[model samples]
Target: MKIDWKNKLTSRKFISAVTGVTIAVLAIFNVDNLTTEKVTALVSAIGLLAAYIVGEGYVDANRDK
Candidate 1:
């Protein structure tokens, strides 16, 4: 019953799904195109950074093993 949140957070599929859902919600609210684009870019950047950080942490953890 436990969720592997680390894997989820680092998953490209999961990140893309989140970005899609965010865009959908923005569209539903009739957000301006510029604002939506900005939000999307920010989300994508954050997702990439998060994945990189997690991946590096995993590598560092296993480096001495």
Candidate 2:
């Protein structure tokens, strides 16, 4: 099956997670304290982004019957 990059980029989950990760990255990189909450948040944000990307890839790959 052919994958649609545009569709993946426009995916809700993909966009949401990537945005969250981008914010977290910005905050963590700029913040002075890397507290437990900050670390947990960063991990969650990155995890969400990864999961969405993988999900989008999977859906795209299996779009054809």
Candidate 3:
């Protein structure tokens, strides 16, 4: 099966995935003395952001036409 990387690169999934990874990396490397509550909040925020990104893409794609 051929992988359509061009479309993948420009897709909402790609954006959200990259954003999530970036957030994880930032939290792991930049945060000092992390706690469970902080980690949970960070992950929850990322999930919400990712969902918003995907929902926005869907809305944009299906906007009045």
Predictions ranked by lDDT, top down? Answer: 1, 2, 3
Candidate 2 positional error at 60, Å? 0.5
State each model's CA lDDT, in order. 0.95, 0.67, 0.65
How displaced is residue 64 in candidate 3, in Å? 5.4
Going through the candidates in the order shown, the clash numbers are 0, 0, 0
Best by TM-score: 1
Which residues of candidate 3, in runs, are more than 4 Å off?
Answer: 1-34
TM-score of 1: 0.92
Local accuracy of candidate 2 as per-residue lDDT tens digits, 1-65:
99987666656667566656766776777754456457656656665676677787778989974
Clash pairs (backbone) in predicted model 1: none
TM-score of each: 0.92, 0.45, 0.46
By TM-score, rank the candidates, best first.
1, 3, 2
- Candidate 1 per-residue lDDT, tens place, 3-49, comes to 99999987999889989999999999999999999999999889989
Error of 3 at 39 (Å): 0.1
Model 2 lDDT, residue 8, Cα:
67
Best by lDDT: 1
- C-alpha positional error of residue 51 in candidate 2 after TM-score superposition, expressed in Å: 0.5
